[model samples]
Target: MSGEGNEPQAIRKLQPGKLVIASHNAGKVREIAALLEGRGLDVISAGDLDLPEPEETGTTFVMNAELKARAAADLSGLPALADDSGLCVDALGGDPGIFSARWGGENKDFNHAMGLVEDKLAAQPDAPRDAHFVCALALAWPDGHVEWFEGRVDGTLVWPPRGTKGHGYDPVFLPIGYDITFGEMDEPAKNEISHRGDAFRQMVAAVF
Candidate 1:
């Protein structure tokens, strides 16, 4: 909802203090905390504070991330970080863009979601079936300053899930120029090329 700045903006160092990660998902929280830890930042998930899960009504990833970050910053009285991510398929016209999590309904059935994707691509023999995962990270300061960064990895959707290393759509999505799926890749390798990694790098550049 603001102008894009190519040059990195100033981001305050989080002082050897705790920063709340505004997310209910433990996996996401762990990943973010690990990333921030590399910068000498003490990170804690909102769940640790028993904060209520804010409804993600925003239409876009950036909006939703900002909404969560703002809420956490206001409630915790400290800087907050949040991320919104999802898989977007070009063949299906981005059917799962914002609804990637609950694509199978409120239960968040990954099996059902994967099945649906396979079914949609089954009939389209000539379909591109190209897909990518988009991750957007937002940081909100208590004083009302906010910054956002985004990253994506282009890939294609494959039938049948593969490895179990990563979570949520990782098994079926194969990044370009790679033979193995993301879930099959080692943790360090995946972290090096992942969308989250890119966004986190941008965030780090802004801060340190």
Candidate 2:
């Protein structure tokens, strides 16, 4: 992590050493790692360290991200990064904002969760099918100091889904100004415009 001169005084600069990613989701971990590549940091996941996943009691994405980052930093005695991201549909009033993972149940079966989303929206097909993906990122030091960033990408929901590249609601999400769904796009293309990508860039500006 190279600190830029314009970094805020309140934000602690990371020095690109061993940092823990507070997550068990392989897709998320992989995305984060890809975003952080070439930053010269030795990154490791909390799952790799056998750290227990903490219950996400926060009502908001930022709060949940902070909770996970704090837990990992405290447990590993190292700097940590955490991300809480989900899909929010206007028709559903953000039904699965924080419970995106939970909607998949203990097995984390996203296919089942996607079916539920489709079923819930079937009753009102003409209703506003607009949606968005939101990502909140938190970086924490061992001493509990934290920096937060949030990003979102507006889009519309596609019925029956499409593609198979990305995870979560990617197959059903067609981002604004794009012809294909997120799942249909390549990794680099998706990363360039995703909610997580935006949040990660903000974090890099603040502390990297």
Candidate 3:
């Protein structure tokens, strides 16, 4: 077989300890850790290791995720998992897709960010309120081996952002077939159908 054919076939499975989550966001770290529960991987956050976050200069979700993952894996000398996720609103022409966190500004205030989303949507009342949450997960080894996965959950963007549970754009996002927002659901319930969960499951099957 050619090297090209064997390239993707090389799977680097995770060892049962000390995997780093390459993010400082408390919400992301907690959610990802929860999804990783019982997987035999000891999950730790970049914050826990005091690893400085790499600048996410990549445009797409996958690129950014890979950047973060590689940075952590190199710094911590451990396999690292990173997630780059966002709520993309169709009405806004996918505004804030990758820039979702930056929409929060220096304070990382999601309430302000949600209000901006609402304001933009409010300007165009005729536009569809449909949106989707996108998550890209990257698992990188210290040796530079990397595997990436992406997932999306379609939903609607609601006004008066409901619920107070989950973080980020959760309060305004109502997943399909459910009247409640992600912010309203408990960790277990949210983990079952989340974009992060979708990506996490794919990584687990391939890497863990």
lDDT of 1: 0.83
Clashes of 3: 0
Which sequence of candidate numbers ranks them by lDDT, best first?
Answer: 2, 3, 1
> Model 1, which residues run further than 4 Å from truth?
1-4, 7-13
TM-score of each: 0.91, 0.95, 0.95
Writing each residue's lDDT as its tens digit, candidate 3 over 80-103 gives: 989999989997889899999999
Please tell me which model should have the higher TM-score, number 1 or number 3: 3
Candidate 2 C-alpha lDDT tens digits along 116-184? 888889978788888999999988889878888888899988878899888888999999999999989
lDDT of 3 at 54: 86
Question: What C-alpha root-mean-square deviation, in Å, does candidate 2 show against the real structure?
Answer: 2.9
Residue 168 lDDT in candidate 2: 87
Taking all chains together, the TM-score of candidate 1 against the true structure is: 0.91
